[model samples]
Target: MLRRLFGDWRPTVLDVLLSLAVGTAGLVESFGRQGSQPGQIGDPVPMAAGAVVAGTMLLLRRRFPVTLLLALIAVGLAVRAVSGGGYYAAWHFYSTLILVHTVASSTEPRSRRGFAGLACVLAAYAFVQTFQHNDVAELMIGAVFVGVAYGSGILLRRQMDQTLRLAERATRLEVEREARARRAVAEERARIARELHDIVSHNVSVMTLHTGGVRMRLGDEHARERDMLLGVEQAGREAVEELRLMLGVLRGTGAPGSGALQPGLDQLDELVTHVREAGLDVRLRIAGEPRPLPPGLGLSAYRVIQEALTNVLKHAHATGADVVITYGRTGLDVEITDDGTGGGPDGPGSDGHGFDGHGSDGHGSDGHGLIGMRERAAMHGGELSAGSVPGGGYGVVARFPLEAPVGVR
Candidate 1:
């Protein structure tokens, strides 16, 4: 309640009206109680009239402060007239005090300064009248009124300046908060876009290429080729299922259900079989017993193997490859090496340094593909390294922490 009264526009307006009313009431009482005797007091009618006129002027002060000041001056003069030079002539100064307040609050600084000068002139005139009538007490009261009104105006001006500065600071803080929120939302959208391109584009392209190969081989009508076509069909179906699971993760549908099996370290045999059928001999070896891994690590492991084999087909042109998996107390390690000579002179089949800078499209994996692999490994608290093997072959080595592997196990 106090905040509403002191901090808002309505409260200021009410304050102005209340101060004017109090000043008017004081004037009225002073007028009506005048003694009307020589050097004793005078009639009350003049004071009452002055109070009414000043109060009426105050009603329009916010809109016309100059007019209100003029009206206050005229009322003070008329009150003195009815008093026959014996009334407490300074009573009207209370109304002048209120006029100063209204003018200071409502008018421009220059206009308010002009009103202050006018008030000083009026105070001097009242001082002359008091000296003429020999009323020392009324003269002192009038002088105090003039001093207080001027002081109050100065204080109110400082308060208004402070209020404006505080409001500007609040507006600036709000703008910065809104800008930060907008930037966070934009960054989230960009991340989603990158994920969609990485997941959907890579999966769909692989499916399309394998499908075309199956069609071409079916046209040949060989029994062994027919078996390869069947294998391709099975692989394509599994790819579709994997794509659906990834899409579910993106859409906030939660991880794939227990019924959906995603390839992990245990599925290395199947991965090698698929690559071999694709005309690359990939041998799989597991050095230690497999343990259940967190879903993200399993998925990352699957994708790394898939990308490595894809690179063998697209860049190696190798007839065979070796895949070695090792389980340790701290983590799992995977290494894929292919004896394909499809990359350039310094390709993955050259010296060990060849594939270091081949993450770009120069290798089978595009720049984004390697970035996706790195991100996946990091997600599982792991690391992945790719380079040429000791011989003329490409090698990819990955290690996922055993204690933790992306999200809750």
Candidate 2:
């Protein structure tokens, strides 16, 4: 609560209350001391009025600090002049000291030094008036008191300046850290893109060229082989197109091939055909009416299914597979299952049966493929899970919201 009141470097209710309390106490002490000194009793009303004025002026100290301090100092001098210069009362000294501290702490360096000098002069004048004998020890004590208040204010100002500098440094460091991380990510992505370009472009170009050469040499005499070669060539061309799209995405460019859209659920049939050509029996089933999904959501769903089917082909040793897509009011759910042992000859739990003997972590033994699928689903506020099915197969399932998050497109 104190921090909240004073944190902004402005006068508040607490400041007003503190001023009133100190002013009232000082007024009462001055009046009480007047009674103890013979013939020193003066007009209580004027003294009380002066205290009230000085205390009320404290409210504007933060906004008009120099003006208020100067006003208070003039009032003190006027009171001393009127009282025949014997000694200023305790309340007068208290108000003067408070104002001196405020001026020193709130003003700029030149102003603070000027105020401190003026305060020292006033302290010397008061010491001379109160101690007519000119005692050196008494003058030195008054000088030290004035110096302490001014020094304390200077110390506080320095501390505040240091705090601000440290805060700025911390903010700069945080910004630099974030910039470094972004640079690292961009560099890594570029490296991966270059490697992918080298591998995919070389292999796909070779496959497409060989398939085309074989198809041309066979002519119509070997129609079956020629037709198969044509399929191979078509598949190679599709792979190249897909690689271009992926490269464009990696490089932050739009999809390639005359603004063609990224592959989505609409391309699932072609994906299944490619897998079938590789000797895997797969069927796709849709349970509800399909709607136009956000591009990112559609793409994520397509990738999950593609990864699951590829896993089935390479690792599940499955003869047949089923791909089920259910579109509901809220979201879409995809399930890919295979009716074969959940392992290949080199895979875990490959005892010619299922993954019954393997642990739960066996599903993730296929490198980062499953992890990548899960990340894709999660990026769209969805989930993916894979495991061995109960009867004699493996299954991969993913769920995604129909409406992609904002900015995903």
Candidate 3:
């Protein structure tokens, strides 16, 4: 109930009510004690009534600060005129101070000059009243009221300006935070794209090659189709597993203490076997004894090899390819090159390279293979290169530094 009646919005409501009630009672008391003496009624009715009106007007001071101030000044003048300076009619000085405070605190700096002019007029009137009555104490008291009210208004305005500045700063920070979140979301989507490309292309190319070989060996169409279907099924299942693993990481649902689904340098042997079984002659050579590598480095290495082998199967049509892993003291180096089958599917639409090597096919050179490989390598601050060897077929080479265990560098 108290808050409803006396909130920040209507600060002067209670003041207006109390002041008018008390002043009106005082006016009645003074009227009952009246006794005329020339221009003086031996009563305080006029003085009390002027106070009630002036205090009531305080309620509108904030809404119409200038107009209320003028009304307050008029009331002061009326009280002085009627009482001829008697019965503490000088208390209107308090109301004048209140008006000055409202003007100083509420009005903008440009309008404050007008308020200052009014304040000067009020000060002069107050000074003249005190001077005429020869009241030094009243004069000093009035001066202090003006000084304190004016000083407090200046300080209050400064506080308001500070609050506005802080609010603007908070707004700017919120905007920047939203922008960063959007950027993070976009980056995550791009990472997912690269992952899908790597998984789909590598698995599908393997399935295709195996299915083709099964057809040639077994002239029985049903048998060939069944084997091809099985290969497709297995590849798809593997792709799904990898995809689920990656999604688990993305969703922060990975096993406790586990991070991203990054199949690294150690998985090269299994990867090689999958291709060899798909009817390719794959020779694996490990130079400079194997060593542990960072998770991102290992994943990049694996993806580079996967893309290279997929390219060979699709474009070179080669029965053979070479997988060489050199583990240097500083970093890991991987090279995959395929001997092309004489004039097989070397033309465009065969591989992302498109034989003419100008990326002629609707499917450009940055095939799923190149794009995935590039993303993997760049993820680890590494570089990947791919192009046809000078004489015959295609080659993919990638190098990534393995400086630490597993974390962002």
Candidate 4:
């Protein structure tokens, strides 16, 4: 508490009160000693006046320390001249020591050195007085007290400076840590994006070529199958286009083409259709008015839905799934659920399909699809969660803010 009260080294009400007490006590002592010796007495009024001046000057010491010290010194000289040079109060010396300490601790090095010289002059004057009175012991004690006060002030000042420097260093380290983390996240995102581009681009290109070949061989004899192949080919083309757009974003390119736009809620129906063609009955239900969304947020939302549906087709043995999209003024929410076997189509013993059990053989079955979906969501300031539902199915849900952060595009 004392440190808090004096931490700034500024004078406050408490300082004023303490100075008042010291001045009053000194005045009382001077009065008490007036008749102690034949010619050692001084006028009570001049002594009290000097003490009052010293205490009043102390109040302004923090703001105008050098000026206050000079004023106090002048008052001390005037009081001695008025008193005929034989008497001095202990509190007067104490007040001078306090001022000396304040100057040492608060001023710049050059100003402090100048004040130290003035203080030495004052000390020498006092010493000369002590010598005239043959009070060697008193002189030694006063000198030691002043030296200690000044030394303590210098130490405190250095400690405070060091504390400030340490605090600044800590802040700098925290900033550097955050910068490093952001760089790592960006690098990881770019790496994942490149891998996705390679995988999806190759698979989609092959699917498009095969579909076109099948349709050509059929030659309109089986219109229905040819139409289905045509639909698949169109979906593959769209997927390739969207992938290109996403790659452009990941690679920090402005856009893949002059008129290209990131796929969003508008293309959700086509996405569901593609999954249905893959042998999973999927339905999309959207709630709320459809409006324009930020490009990044839209892409993230579309990818999340795509991954969820893909998982359903690959693992869920059930014949149907549902996707619900609810849009709010500030955000969008998506939920996808399937009625397939809660674990996998192949039952409990099966570790599901995929390389590591994420979903598809191309990916992993552990949770790669979910992880990628979640990363996409989070990149746009969103969140995603996936798990088996209580009754008997797997579900995935995601929420995204409507507005993208500035500079996201």
C-alpha local distance difference test of each model? 0.62, 0.67, 0.63, 0.70
Each model's RMSD to truth, in Å?
17.6, 14.6, 18.7, 14.3
* Cα lDDT of model 2 by residue, 1-409, tens digit: 9666556666689669857965797578557656535445354555566677777777766665567666776666666566543545556556666666666667555675565655554654464346245578867866677667666766777788789899999999999857755555454335334434645566687889988998999968899998889999999999888877676766565422232345678888999999999899999999987887865677668877877777677667789999999987778999999987654544454433222121111223223455456666777789988776889787888999876434546
Off by over 4 Å in 3: 1-41, 84-91, 110-132, 135-140, 220-409
Question: Could you tell me the lDDT of residue 188 within candidate 4?
Answer: 44
Strongest candidate by lDDT: 4
Q: Is candidate 1 or candidate 4 better by TM-score?
A: 4
lDDT: worst 10-residue window of model 3: 354-363
**Model 4: per-residue Cα lDDT over 242-275, one tens digit each:** 8877877776754223223446678988888888
TM-score of each model, in listed order: 0.47, 0.50, 0.47, 0.52
Q: Which has the higher TM-score value, candidate number 2 or candidate number 3?
A: 2
Consecutive 10-residue window with the lowest summed lDDT within model 1 = 356-365
Clashing residue pairs in all predictions, respectively, total 3, 0, 0, 8
Instruction: Give the distance in Å from residue 121's predicted Cα in candidate 2 to where it truly belongs.
Output: 6.8
Error at 77, model 1, angstroms:
1.4
Worst 10 residues of 4 by lDDT: 353-362
